[model samples]
Target: MDAQQFLEEFGHIANAPGGVGKLRELILSLAFKGELCVPSNEISATLLDDIERQRLEFNGETRKQRLTRQSNTTTNLVGPYEIPKHWSWVSLSTVGHTWGQKKPEDSFVYIDVSSIDNKAGVLRQSPEVISASAAPSRARKVVKKGTLVYSTVRPYLLNIAIIDRDFDLEPIASTAFAIVHPWEGISGRYLYFYLRSPIFVRYVESVQIGMAYPAISDEKFYSGVVPLPPTEEQSRIVAKVDELMALCDKLEAQQQARRKLQNALRQSTLQAVASATSPHELQTTWACLADNFGRLFHEPEDVDDLVAELKNLAVRGLLSEASTTSPDLEAIKIDCAQMRARYIADGLIRRQKLVGMADCEETYPAHWAVTAFDEVAIVIGGVTKGRDLRGKQVMVCPYLSVANVQRGHFKLEGLKSIEIAADELAKYQVHEGDLLITEGGDWDKVGRTALWRGGVTNCLHQNHVFKARVPSKQLLNEWVELVFNSGVGRDYFAGASKQTTNLASINMTQLRSFALPIPPLIEQQRILSVLSELTKHCNEWCRQMERKQAMSTLLAGAVVSSLTGITIEQEEEPMKAPQTELVAPLRLGTTPDIKAQAPLATILARHHGEMSAKDLWQRFGGEIDAFYTQLKTEVAHGWILEPAPAEMREKLADSVSA
Candidate 1:
């Protein structure tokens, strides 16, 4: 699509996922190319000549140099793209100069690349003051007011900012920055935005060398092409960019507010479904959620949450109707006992006193039975390494570690091999349908469970991954897996695991005691079937969200490509929300006293009083929109006390200053 076409259809895709950010890029590209607004009535041919005169005059040099463009040939130009016929292309070297290297003679504000927050194109924190004696070797570049300091190291990070204010001490930037003191015609604000442009960013990504500390060289950096306009046009472009950027910022905020409202609505709807007791109640609540599906599920993460909630419902026996009679615990135990005998006879597992036990109260369906995990399955710890068995016969085989076992499925790639005594291989060898549960890792990942369908022959498991062999006749592997990875199973592990710092672990005994809710054999199949169908729909929902995002990105990219006369391709990478760890991951926090309280209130109550926004976000199981909205309702009702306003301001200020 051409620029005109894009503008005409802007309303169709300007609010898609990551669309506002894309729009900001389009604005920058358009501004640089002089396509954002009408050209000035008058044009100056000596704009470049005047800028050159100012450079030599500022440097106190009589010598003049010719401008050399860094032609990546991005738009078949002498520069990266075709600019307005009146505007000229110039080298970054011709545009500016930097203060020569110097050793500090006194205390100075050390403005390192870390001081800048690339997002805002400003210093994120107060540059620290360093005494002359303590100054680092790299603290040699001088940055006065109006100078643009662009970090040479890791240029893709876009650690480029203008020195807009003076400091208490003389600000000495780290040598990592290529300080650009622009000539008379260049606007520092305009230059700052130029360096932050998507076009510039893509150029940096292509030219930066090295893997660990990828950076652009001074020689290459100086040769970078700048799309220059008349001095009058520069001011015009900057003004327009500022105006559009402010709109983007406003749009971004509105999008956030909209998402929060959607989240609030979705969360409340899902909660209704989860809390429904009777089948009729479940049906009504589920229908309500289904009715608002369009509003509730916008992103892949939203659908993921739906899937997770479905599993939670499945495990709790709330997904389907239960039989009028309670499940026969004795009959299930009898069947398991018969299976256990065969397991013992084969010398695969040892006899245990208890079938299994639940850590929490049993509030399951009347037709469901509960028992300890070990009753129906052979729960055994895997092989431990570093034993002095040199004399003993051993064989090398692929083994599953905690990393290899993810919830629901095994990640078999990069399977590390371990040497085990040939005799002990059978004990550690995981069979088809055996459940592999991680013993410990990051606290949240400590009890991750995945079913092992044999991929590698004679595969064994590491000590940190426990293997459970559940007989097919006694319990289906799928049913057990569903429960173990559900909210109930996760809660039990989080509460029972021994924790230290961010690490957590559950011992073999704890794994054996895990409570597995058992429905009638026929009901198990029925529930799984229903869950499978629901999950398929949720997956389709996510796919549709992804498809929509992909199309939006392409449309945005087409607009940018056409407007700038540059080929800009949009990569459709799956969005991944970070997994958050909480101090109170599995605790049944205190119940909220406020009747107006909902998700956020309940989470804060669970954590005793207050929790970090990050922690609360994960627990709330909703988007930022819902969480903040619910939190506001609680705080507004005087049910929650927030941090002092002054403290918040200081924290925010310090963050920006850093």
Candidate 2:
């Protein structure tokens, strides 16, 4: 069917998420049914004759022999009606020798599914030397130069490759394989496509065992029936599919580029807004962004970036530029001194060693007091645990675990319920407006703090949380939150932290010694109000971005389905055409199979004389892909980045030139 007609019939699939995947399945089913192409009179006549001859030959034998031959072909084909006219039902094994090779020895050249491109059905390479034990067995089948190999273990792996070079063959595959060598007029490429169809994959999955390691058996492999076309038509179908797949690849690339550009534009808009330094500047920035709201935001990530920028701006004192007058330092200091004296007299708080500093310069806002964090608030360590409690039955007390602490904030998702005696609840009960700081974690998060807004009435904290119960009458909780999240707090936390493996942590003493910039109570409230309003705005923008992202994802899937969708007619009809003739065998390259290589600098010069490291790595493909994947995972696990060599710049420059 033509593209336009196909779309008219199955257009709904194009608009749904994962619709393209369904379309691909439909196309494959139709292709096998011979409905993808129109049939000619001559081809139809010849196909009918071939079917009749086969039937006659079967009937000529004794009833027992005939039954056995039919069973060998397709046991479930109860009658000739099972196969359409001008169509023949035969096992794929009829075209190739099954279990053709036996292992000759312990070592020989070998190929694994990983070596093949699952997408293009081409063999990809690695440079690492394979262990002698891993070499294919001596008796493994020798695929002829034009034969195709499909990985049977993961039917969906779609690892099909056409053999070109005649290597001294070894028992190449694990028992999980169904190798196909086309007979005189058939095309291996066409057969490869047929095997990749979702219908075939579903057939494989139907019999596969084990959820974790699903696999199809060898017996099942040789039993499944396949649709075959004339040799010439097989070539035509193969060529058409290849051209269309390439077009799909180009479309995917374009979509990815568009998404990237959209993200960049969103980021730039956020940056521009954040650069505003005054109320007028901020108003101008807001106006520009408000005008282009639809254009600037498009995904959840963009909104997240904007939220981060808002947090940064809030801490930097840019969010409240309009009503943020100079803070009154003397008044704040007097108030803090009074509160500390009262706490000491009541013995409600401890007297900790505080950090002292010289008076600040004029640039230090006249209305803001600079003092050690201890003077403004008390910092205490969490209760010590005496033993491992993994399997113990404890009370279900709402408790904060180490994971609950974030950078100057708390995330309550996956909050754990701990076993604490009802009598001991008084000691750990969390109150509204009380700040909880992470006492031990990565250095950046060690001193992170968040105020509890009392989401739960009786939630208590765990031993890992250091509570800072501040007086709401004197201090603004939002102001404290902003300070703790700011860069100044980050630097102090980093400096006081002690490193162990991938983690860095701080003790209570570090928190007490940390300096803080305190503003007058009124000024703090003003700052808090302005920051709260602006952050809410940023949050709203983020939500819109997330919605857009969902839409984009849906759209992309729809487009993909449109390109690969199968039509209604193809599913019901089977076409007869001449078989495909192979004029040339597929080319397969041979290279060492090492998985890891020297640093990019060393490899760049050898591969591309003067190319950038990025360009050279892309050319290499496999090792670089593995390296980056590993690197990103390590980083996520909190490993620090090791410094790259200084010579990398020169190497990268040379690669760029090349």
Candidate 3:
């Protein structure tokens, strides 16, 4: 329950994902509670008098008007938590003076929420100057040296800092901040630490109004309680905090350097296995990695490099030996021609232009035959929207876009439907065993392939995704997808696709010309079998790493909770929509959302407006992290509010978090 016990476990705690932040919160909490430093015989009462006298002399106001007026304004005021008897509980207004606001009359430097480096609680030091005529309306608050600027909007972001340097021009902050200039005898650094502590932030959360844009008004913020210490003890606590925080900085830097080293080693070792010239060397290199796997692979993300190397080895005819028999290219061409004739006769698909096949540079077993993608498969573009169909009969059908059609899977949730001419559906409707490949997007997303096995019936693809059907039974969709999604296919796409500012796209002609290495049906199945077995081990390794990470995180939380004397509150159950809508203004501790905000709820499973909404009475009372988690999830998926993926949308959430 003290610094000694916490420091003993610092190494283990810092190894966890978010341990350093928890350690910081604990340090601030203890410092404010009089546990971090030895107390002096001097009590805070003497310092309180010094602060009031200085403030009164500066403002020229009497005690009745300045100190006691609304200082205890609440009906029954009580401090949030007990402090040492030597310390006193005082409102922030008693310790700091509020400043006036004014619009910029001339060019000035503006500091907004974006100006803060939240982690360090310091400015980024990049000043942005605003013109007097072009100043934003929100830039109206004044800032001076030694003043603590704490953002009232999204207060949990910890956008709080003390101005320490002079600006050539007047510095104006956005109205979003509550500027607090400390009175004499109060250390601004100590006040800054207490303001960012968990207990203080929790109090802010409980008093803030509204759910969507929750913010603490300047009035409520100034009325919040602060644990005041004697001037001597304040200086001691600040010094100790700085010393311990410097140690934390060292731990954090060492941990990051270790992870960087591990990642680099994994990449080099995997590269050795991937670049092996023969099956013997591949086995030798892989054995070396397997021998040192425990030392190299410590995170679940490391498996990505391992899996990529496996794919490269598989396509090179190194994972499994090539069979004596070769695929019959003539027979495959004949089968494709017969299917094309039948489709032409039935008006199913268009007559694709036969194009010359391009050569692939990589060497492969002579037993494996090479063919262009169009020779064995029918590749076609999907339907384009915005066409005039005013007089035509149309039907709404679920379709796949670049978002739904992922590299090796589909994101079926929140499926969208579009109206298409009923008769035109035949050409666009995708069936089972079709390979869906993205036409264009980012450099990494171009030519990404996924196989469709009928997750949603009558599903069509949009123009951004290409649908390739292998009508011939000789070529399996599974095999084609494997080759198309492997390193070979990705390399071709990266080289051939038209690229601009990290975005790239490929036309049907480019897709049809892709060189595919074809093996006999039996050999294809054998290679897949080998890949399946090896990837299974890799998958299990990744799962083990995740479980280990979870255990480390749990242990760190438990130790922190025990030492800090904090009861980790259970997360609130998700909010449910009422059977009937209510009229506003709403009451405390009741449903807050009407109907339009219900889309936030729809993001969850089978739930409409299901996001957690606290009744006004219990505004974020139990746990601060629960509220922050809700905000983090919302921000990660906020792009979905556009209901369109113009570009990135928490794509990392699926890839890395998984």
The numbered model that scores best in lDDT is: 3
Q: Using TM-score as the measure, what is the rank order of every candidate, best first?
A: 3, 1, 2
Global CA lDDT computed for model 2:
0.56
Instruction: Give the TM-score of each candidate.
Output: 0.79, 0.62, 0.83
The lDDT for every candidate, in the order shown, is: 0.76, 0.56, 0.77
lDDT (tens digit, per residue) of candidate 1 on 458-512: 9998889998776546367889899888888888899889999999999988888
> For model 1, what is the C-alpha lDDT against the true structure?
0.76
User: Candidate 3 — which residues are off by over 4 angstroms?
Assistant: 1-8, 60-69, 73-78, 570-658
C-alpha positional error of residue 117 in candidate 2 after TM-score superposition, expressed in Å: 4.5
How does model 3 score by TM-score?
A: 0.83
**TM-score of candidate 1 against the unseen true structure:** 0.79
Q: Which regions of candidate 2 fall more than 4 Å away from where they truly are?
A: 1-72, 75-97, 100-104, 109-121, 127-171, 176-186, 202-225, 321-351, 356-372, 383-399, 406-431, 438-450, 453-466, 482-658
lDDT tens digits, residues 1-658, model 2?
A: 3556556645445333344444555556556656556542234335434544655553433453344334557423332122235545555654444325555454544665666777667766531233455554432654556777777665666767776555543435544555666655567777777778754665677777777667776556656656655656666667767766665556556656876888888778777877776658877987887888777665545566666667656655566533345545445556666766676676545564555542322133444566666666655445445535565555556777678877556788877676655555555777777778876675555767788878875677666778775543556766777777665566667667888887887776677666666665666666677767867877777765554444444334333333333211111122221122212111111221221112232233344324443443343232333435533443343331322331222223545659
Question: Distance from true position, residue 205, model 1, in Å?
Answer: 3.9
Ranking by lDDT: 3, 1, 2
Q: Give the TM-score of candidate 2.
A: 0.62
